[model samples]
Target: MNQYLNHLHVLRLLVQRELSSRYKGTIIGILWLFLQPLIMVIVYSFVFSVIMKVRIPGMDSSYHFALYLMAAMMPFFAFQEALISASNSLFANSSLLHKSTLPAILLPLVPMLATVITETIALVIIVIAAYLLLDQVSYYLLLLPFLVLIRLCLSLALGYVLAIMSVFVQDLRQALGLILTVILFITPIFYPVDMIPTELIPVNNLNPLYHLLDAYRAIIIRAELPGIGLLYMAGFSILLLCASVYFFQKTIERAKEFI
Candidate 1:
């Protein structure tokens, strides 16, 4: 517990430094963090709903299709940002790794925590706007925190593993970008799970991310509790978290030598 608290202290400082350094000389400064995602949501909403006329099955509520997708997309944005940022974090902060006596293992953790903090602030604004626009709220709203935690765990797990690997394999950083692009499409971010063919249901069920996104839509759009899939998401999160910690510790010493 003492070690964890010490790590948390280091994490907080890293997050603060990142937030400030990110926009140190910019005119808009921190506002850009909130603005960029909001703008992307608007543009994507137009292209997917207005131009392409894609439909989100099982979500028949009067809430605008854009908002429905946006709610689900926000968490995914955080997940992807944390992943990509963490992949390069060690390399980006290599100076600190070489010069500082702090736990080198914690360097990758910095980006994950930084992105989590920024995304939490953005999520609050998105949720309030969604409630006002849709004019509806459900008890299932209570599940939002659990869902966010699942995502956070998933991000940290994958981020830790990838961060260590990237130091040894430089090409992994570029490859991860391409892989994440493919993952977003197949993860049900743009469409509902039911819209997927029935035969694919069994296969899609294996994807933990599908369950997470489905759980989000269920609460916001379906107004019902997340069904069996929530359990699957929780189990998968635990499994990933454990696996990442094992991998990180096993390779952590080697990571320092490589960096």
Candidate 2:
């Protein structure tokens, strides 16, 4: 218990440093945390709603579409950022790792916690936007924290594994970039799920991210509880997180040698 507390203390310090350095010397500093996602939401709303003439069925306003996009994009952005940052955590902190006795797990954990802070800001913007645009936010929004917890678990599980492997495979960073792009398009963040082809529904359903974003839309847009599939995915993510920790502990010794 004392060891875990010590690790958590170390993690808190690392996360604080990571977040502070991210926007250091910038004029806006932490305001960029709120502005960054807000700008992305506005750009996406303009591109899809104005330039492309895209519209969500049964919803007349472009603002409504933006709300939908915000709900999905905020979480997806956090997941993507966490994975990419965590994947490089060891390499980026290689000098510190070599000189300190800190547990290597704390390196990847810093990014995960930092991503969560930014994500929380994005989520607050989503709530305020929904209340203003939609005229009322859902009571279901109360469940959002639980949903975010599931996403955190999923990110950490994948991140730890990727972080360790990335020490050995330099090309993984590029590969993950391309793969995340493909995933962003395929995951239905911009379009309604019904817009997907009928034949592909089963395959898309198999994607855990599809379920996660779907749950976000359900809570934010539809004012409904997430489906059973989300509950199942939550369970799976927790188990996967436990497994990834064991995997990281076992492989980190070898990974440190390479680093």
Candidate number achieving the greatest TM-score relative to the actual structure: 2
- The TM-score of candidate 2 is 0.94
Task: Assess each prediction's global lDDT (C-alpha) against the native.
Answer: 0.79, 0.87
Off by over 4 Å in 2: 1-3, 46-53
**Candidate 2, 106-220: lDDT as tens digits:** 8888989888889888888777777776785778998988888899999999999999888889799879999899999999897888989999999988889989998988988
Weakest ten-residue segment in model 2 by summed lDDT: 46-55
Q: Among all windows of ten consecutive residues in candidate 1, which has the lowest summed lDDT? A: 55-64
lDDT of 1 by residue, 1-259 (tens): 8978987787788888988898999999988888877786667656766786655555453345777787777788788989998898888988888887677667877777777776676666666656776676787787788888888888988998898989899899989988988888988876666678999889888888888877877777667788797797788888988999889889877787987
Q: List ranges where model 1 is wrong by over 4 Å.
A: 1-7, 41-63
Alpha-carbon lDDT of model 1? 0.79
Per-candidate clashes come to: 0, 0
Model 1 residue 223 lDDT?
Answer: 71
